[model samples]
Structure formats: C-alpha cells, structure tokens
Target: MIKLFLPLCILFLMSGCKKSELEAVNSSPTVSADKAVEVAAYEVEAPTPPKEISQKLLPDVNQSAQPPITPKKIDTIAKKIIKNGNMKIQVGDIKKAQTQVGDILKKNNAYIQSEQFQNTDVDDNLDLVIRVPHKNFDALVNSFSDGVGSVLSKNISSDDVTEEYTDVSIKLANKKIYLEKYRDMLRSASTTKDMIEIQETIRELEDEIDLAEGRLRLIDDRVNYSTLNLSLYKEKVRSSATSKIGFGSRFADSVTQGWNSFMSFLLGIISLWPFLLIIPILIFLWRKWKSGRTKP
Candidate 1:
C-alpha cells in the first residue's frame, strides 16, 4: 500500500507544475483599453459626411446664379383698333357728286369696295362701300359731308381687337417653337414609327402656325383699313332737269292711241261674221213676208 501511494503523490506533483506553466503562458501583459484605442485611432479612416450635409458644403459650379429674364408688357399705343363709318348725304346731281367723291377717294389713296345704284320715279339713289386706310377714314367721311351734299346722317364705330390680336400672336409664336422642336426630333429619329410620329407632330404644328398667322393677318388688315358706307340721293321731281312731256310727244301719243282703237274695232267686226250672216237671212225673209201680205 505504501509503494502505490508514493507513485500517486509524484503524479499529482507533476500535474500541478504543468497547470502553473500553462497559466503563465496564457496570461497577457496588463495595458489600459483606452490607451490601446487612442494609439490605433489615427490609422483608421475618418467617418463619411452625411449626404445632406455634403451637398450644402460644395455647390454646383456649372449652374447659373442670375435670375431669369422677364418679358416686357405691351403698350396701349401698340394695340390694334378697327374703325368704321357710315354716312348719308343728299346732293343736287348724283352723277356729279359721285364723280367728285371718286376724285376725293383717289386723292386719298382709297378705293371703292362696292357700289350700287337704284332707279326710282322720285330720284336715283347711289350706295357706295369704300375701304380706306385708317388714317384716311375720318378724312374721307368728312369730305363726303362737305363736298358731296347736305349731311343727312353720319355714324362712326371703333372696335378694339388688342386682346384677340395678342392671343393669336402668342399662339403663333408657340407653334413656331413647337415646330422647331419637332424638326429636331425628326432629325434624331431612329425607327420608322418614331420618324412618322415626329413628322405628324411637325405637320400639326405647321398647320397651327399657319392658322394663327392667318388670324393675325386678318387682324392686321382690319386695323390698317377702315370701312365706309355712303348713301347719296337727289329728288328727281324737285330737280331742274325733271322729265316732262312736250307738245311733239303728246301729238305722237294721240296718233298711237287712235291707231290702236281702229285695229281693235276691225278685230271685233271679223269675230261677228257668222252672226251677221244669220241677220241678213232674217231681213230677206221679213221682206218676202211683207210682199205676201200686200198680195193677200
């Protein structure tokens, strides 16, 4: 029993020495964690800035800083106004007055748009529709009043088309811009479908542009030219050159009536020929009867 116990005590002493050696080898040197973190901090990269914060620090250099330019306002003087007028005058001689008015119009660079003449027992009336430049509108009306004859009626009208004109102008400009863009799109087109679509768009824009331009042209014409309606009249019965029947005309009228009456009487006698035959037969019978009575 003593021998067995001696060997077990030796093994136990060896195991304790091995355990102490392992503990000494596994243990690390004592150092503060704060000191270790500070030492290695410089080697690490800095934290990235937030997306919002970074944008504020550096702005885009290519962008413009100035404000956009604004368009100017249109003036009233530049507006379009259409003028119209109407006049009625009574003159001594319509033909002479018409000639005078025509001369006046020619002098003012005006022209007759339309004219009408009416014939009546009382008088011959003349109606004239004239188109003159706006500058000459009032002048032409005044000339008719002063030179043509007595002014019986006069009227003037003014129409403001500024808003409509401006609207058409703006629409025309927009269509022009759209047409340019569509043309560019057509140039860059790849597929047939894309080309056809762009071409159609361009055609539509061109049509719109044309329509707007036409409207603008009409407005310009209306504003540039003024319309005038003039009426002229002269009393035929009151005029010195009135129509009258003379002695010679009366003699000819009487002869024509007498001839017409004789022709009418001849036609009536020809239509009674059958009845006249029967009347002659009855007269013969009556004469024979009277002779027979005398014999009895």
Candidate 2:
C-alpha cells in the first residue's frame, strides 16, 4: 500500500510539470505574435518622399521636345492682266520720225487710235495713242525705247480686268438665252394681240442682245490689245551765228537794235501831222526868243 501510494505521487508531480511547460510555450508564441503586429504597424505608418522628388523620379512621355514644322504649297493658276504704257522721247526729224513710228506699228500688227502733229516756234511734237497686240506689247515697247530716240519719261502699268471681262461675258450669254425665249414666244402666239405683244418683246430682247454683244466686242478688243500713249518731240536747233557769238557780237547787235529803235521813234513822230506842225512852230518861236535875248 505504501509503494503504490509513492508511485501515484511521482506520477502526479510529472503531470503537473508537463502542464506548466505547455502553458509557457503557448505564452511565448502569443508574445512573438504581438511583436510581429507592432512591427507591421510601424512599417505601414512610415513617412513617404515629397511630391516634387517623386515626379522627378518618374518622367512623363506626352510632352514633345522637338520644334513644329510647316510646309508650303505651290500655286498653279495664271492671272489675267491688262497692260498700259506712257512714253515721251526726243527725235531728230518730226515728220520722218512720225513716218517711222507708223511703219513700226503696222509691222507689229498695231493701229493708231489717235495722232496729233503740233508744229510751233519752239518745237515740233507728235502725240500718238496706239493699240497693239498684247503679245507684242513688251517687244514693241522695247523696240521703241531702243530705236526711237532719247527717252524723256516712261511709265508702265497693269490692271486686273479678268473680273470685268467675266461679268460682261455672263451677261451676254444670258441675254442671248432671253432672245431665244422671246423668239419661241413669238412662234407660239396665235391671236393678233398676242402676236403684237410677242413681237414687241422680241424687239426689246434683240436690242438687249445687240448691246450685250457690243459690250463683249469692246472687252475682247481691250483684252486682245494693249494701249500705249506716246509723245515725240524734235529738239530746237541753235543757229550757227548765235552758237559762235562772243561779247563783241552781242554788243554790236545791241547798238544796232538801239539805233533802229531811235529811227523808228522819229518816223512815228513825223507820221503824226499835228505833232509835226507843232514842232516846227515851237522851233521858230524858240529861235526868235533867242535872237531877242542876244540883241538885248
């Protein structure tokens, strides 16, 4: 009975020791888990870098660094231009130069619109306005400049008449259409009153068509020809004697002119009969008074 009791006591002591060791192991694991949780919270709460530094670390790709480029397009349309010119030149012989100018115009398929020859004591001048083919405008101007004489003045100008020409053309075309419509109306007329009205309308349309055609013709002429206004003059020649005169010649001419003027004055006074008689009576009275004074 004593041995059995002693064994039971030893068994009880071993069981108590085993239980204490198990509790200690469980407590150690709990402490370790709390430490791990604290470390995780500290890591999550740590401060981050400033926004500017973060932006510098990660660059954007949308912003371009190269310059923008531009390209040019070529034009392909031709412009319509009306040319005009004005010129003045000096020539040797007015008549000969006028003839030569006419010949040049004919050769260039041109015609004179107007011409005037003015001869004065000072100079002989020819003024001309010519209409020349547009294709020969430049060539004619160059030829006149080089072959005519010394140029005094030159002016060349251009106007854009394309718009005017197109407008006139469109009007002319519309008028022709109206003319055809009026003719058709005249054909469809059956009553005398209707016929008279249609005929009158046709006449009106015809007149309008004529006017439009006239305007078109004028435009065509202007477009096909270029206008040139020209003036040519002959230089006055100095007489050889005047050109060679010195001081002596000028003095002689002055004396001769003065003498001729005095003679002409005397002749004028003689022509006045009343003045002639009065002069003779005054001369006689003066002579008598002089003799009386001498006697006294």
Candidate 3:
C-alpha cells in the first residue's frame, strides 16, 4: 500500500508541471499580439514625406528662382509736319528779278506752282506760288531773302499733323477690315434684304475709306512739299518836264508854241469880217443924220 501511494504522488506532480507549461505558452502568444498591436499603432502615428509632393514643390521653387519675362515694346513712328510761308519782296526790275528767281528755283529743286504779273503806272508786281521740298524750304527762303530782293514781309507757319495722321490711319485700317467683313457677309447672304443691307454698309465704308485716303494723301503732300507765296514788287520812275533838257531844245519848243498862238489870232480876225462891214455902214448913217440936223 505505501508503494502505491508513492506512484500516485509522482503522477500528480507530473500533471501539475504540464499545466504550468501550457499557461506559459498561452501568455507568450498574448504578449506577442500586444507587441504587434503597439508596433502597428506606432507606424500609423509616425510622419513620412511623399516623393510626389516634393516633386511638385520643387517645380514651384524652381519657377520662383527663375527670372520673370517682360513684354516686348513697339517701335515709334515718325512725326508729320506741314510747313507754309508767305513773303513779299521789293525788287529792282520785275523781268530781271523773275529770271533770277527761276535760276534760284532750279538750283533749289523747286518749281513755280503758279505765277502772275501786273504792270501799273505806280509799280510792277510779280506774284509766284513756290513749292519746295521740306528740307529745302528754309534754304529757299533764305536765298530769296538774301539774293533775290529786299524783304517787305515774311510769315512762316508749321502744323504738327502727327496725331491727325495716326488717327486717320488707324480709322482707315479699321474701316477696311469692316469693309472686308461686309463683303464676305454679302457673298454669303441668303436673303435679298441681308444682301442689300450689306451692300449699303460696304458702299458707305468704301466712301469713308476713300475720303480718309485722300486726306492722308493731301497731308503727305503738304508735309513733303512746303508752299511759299512769294511776291516781287518794283516801283516805277516817272518822267519830270522841268529837269534834264538842253537849252536849244527848250528854245525850239517855245518858238513852235509861239507860232501856233499867232496863227490862232489871225484866224479869229478872219471870222469877224462880216462884223467889220456892218460897223462902216453904221458910221455913214450917223454922219448923214448930223448934217441934216444942223440945216434944220
């Protein structure tokens, strides 16, 4: 009976050892799971930068570091100027002065646009309208003032037409654009009313364009060529009777005049012959009456 009790106690000790080993294994698994959960939570809370976000920011930084681009500037146009002048000069001889003026014009590359001449008892005048290149305008005026004759009056004027020219040019371009559009519309018009309206608009635009072009042409002409109104004047010298005559000539003229006076007196006596005969008849009658009275 002692031996049996000893074997039963040994078996009980073995079973208790197995139970402790099983509990240790179960606790290890629970600790491993808790470690895994903590690791996952740590990963979730930690911060990480994405390469795509860095790339996007890098482009923005590079762009900010680069220089800014500026817009290009447009070129400026030339100025438009119109010049005009009026001058009056006193000359010695009109014909000779006219010839001299012609020579000067040829030298200056100018021409007489119009010319007029007047001769009077008091003076002679030669009026000329001269057109000269803009560059040569002042030179021509100086030449005429210094060489041609004495200047009586001079007037010079300059007009700045740059603004007007620019405005007209822009308006003309716009009108041409509208005109083209109208023509295209007219071509594609499906109805008579639309065609007629487009045609009318086109006509109006064409007229405006023509007028603007003509004005520009006129302005260009005035700017390129300066106009000058030139007047040449010469005073006449009158002849005097009291001056510069030889004694012999004066004596001859006086003798001729005296002879004319004597002839006129003789003709007057011939015209009175009828009156002389009547006087004689009256004298005879008077004497007869006196004798008759004395006898009575």
Candidate 4:
C-alpha cells in the first residue's frame, strides 16, 4: 500500500507540470496576434511624405518645368551692299562710241541688259542699261567716261543691307525650327481638331519661309550685280545753205512782192467803177443848167 501511494503522488505532479506548459503555449499565440493588430493600425494611420506624394501625383511636372530650347548662334556675316550708277555722255560719233563701249564691256566682263536708240532732227541718243560685277563697276564707269565719250552727268548710289539680311536670316531659322516641331506634333496627333490646327500653322509658316527666302535671294542678287544706266548722245551738223537763206530764196521773195503790187493796183481801179456812173450823171445835169442860164 505504501508503494502504490508514492507512485500516485508522482503521477499527480507530472500531470500538473504538463498542464502549465500547455497554458503557456496557448497564451503566447494570443499575445503575438494582439501585437500584430496594433502594428497594422499604426501603419494605416501614418501619412506619406509630401515630396513622395507630389512626385506620384504630378509625374510630368518636372519635364514641363524644364527650360525651352534656345536657337543656334549664327556666325559673323559679311557686309551686304547694293550699288547703282547713272551716267550721260556726249560723243562725236555714236557708232564709234558704241563700238568702244562694247570693247570696254568685254574687258570688264559686263553685259548690256537693255538698249534704246532715238533719232531726232538735231541729235541721236543711245540709252543702255548695264549689269557688271561689283569689283569691275568703277573700272567700267571710268572707261566709259574717259575713253568712250565726254560725261554730261554722273551719279552713283550705295545701299547697306547687312542688318536687314542678318535679321531676316535669324527669323527664317527660327521659323524653320517651329515648322519642324509643328510637323512632329502633327504626326503624333491623336485628335482631328488638333491635327487640323497644327496643319494650318505649318502651312502659314511655310508661306512665310518662302517669302523670306525670296527676299534673301533678291538681296543677294542686288548685292552681287551692280546696275548702271548709261546714255550716249550725238548732235547732227547742219549744212550752211540749210542754216541760212540762199540767193534763190531771196529772188522768189522779190517776185512774190512784185505780183502783190500789181494785183493791188487792179483792185483799186475796180473800186472806182461805181463812182464813175454818178460822176457822168452829175456832169450832164451841170451842162443842162448852164445852157438854161445862158438862154435866159
């Protein structure tokens, strides 16, 4: 009986130890679950950083805030000048002068743009419009002045177009850039209305570009070639007989005066005919009166 009692006591102690271990294990899981719930609540209540929130909301703002692209710098340009001249010359012989002018033009690599000739009773005139290289303009003018004929009038004019050219060039370059950008936009366009607007803008830019290019071309042409207006004059010599009245003219004048005098005398005799009839009647009346008095 003592041995059985000792074993029962040992068993009871062992069972009690097992129950305590089980309770510890179950309580630990509940504590862990409660801590996890508290952590999740804290996470839900926290606010995001301001910078990170802005970045997420405005994704393209950084790109939009970037500065615009600048245009390319142009190199230093040369000066542009347009020159024109006007001259009038008198020569002894127009044909000879014209030949000399042709030779001079050949030497100077010049060409006549237009020519006009006029012949009047007293003088002959030749007008020429000449286009020559800028380098040879002065030489040609001197040659015509000294060798071709005597100068009556001379005028030379110069216009500076450097500023104008530079300004136009810059504007044209900018327009081209805008045109390319618009074309790209048109290609990527999604809406019909946007595409139509971009196309209209592109068309207008193209027209402006063309006009600017045309102006540049015209300016270049004037700068490259100089214009010269030349006039040649020749006076005709009159003969002595034509200049002065000759003996034949004087003889014809005398014959005309004699004929005029004879006609005047005949007209005077015809005017006296009416008075002649009245004179005869008065004479007859006077004779009758004198005879009556002598009879009384």
Provide TM-scores for the models.
0.54, 0.51, 0.59, 0.57
Candidate 4 lDDT over 191-250, as tens digits, reads 999999999999999999999999999999888999999999998999886789889998
* lDDT (tens digit, per residue) of candidate 1 on 1-296: 99999999999999999999887766533344556777678547567789778756666662345365788976443779999888889999988998999899998899999999998988888999998999998888888878779998999999999988887777777789888988998999999999999998888888888888888888889899999998998877655444566888889999999999999999999999999899989999999999999994
Off-target runs (Cα >4 Å) in candidate 3 are 1-75, 241-296
Q: Name the candidate that leads on TM-score.
A: 3
Residue 138 error for model 1, in Å? 1.5
Candidate 1 wrong stretches, greater than 4 Å: 1-77, 238-296
Deviating ranges (above 4 Å) for candidate 4: 1-73, 245-296
- Candidate 2: segments with Cα more than 4 A from true spot: 1-80, 99-103, 238-296
RMSD of 2: 21.4
**Model 3 per-residue lDDT tens digits across residues 171-274:** 99899999999988888999999998999999999999999999999999999999999999999877776557889999999999999999999999989999
Candidate 3 or 1, higher TM-score: 3
TM-score of 3: 0.59
Best-to-worst ranking by TM-score: 3, 4, 1, 2
Error of 2 at 59 (Å): 54
Lowest summed-lDDT stretch of 10 residues in model 3? Answer: 51-60
Superposed by TM-score, candidate 2 places the C-alpha of residue 88 at a distance from the truth, in angstroms, of 0.8
How much lDDT does candidate 1 score?
Answer: 0.86
Count the clashes in each prediction. 0, 0, 0, 0
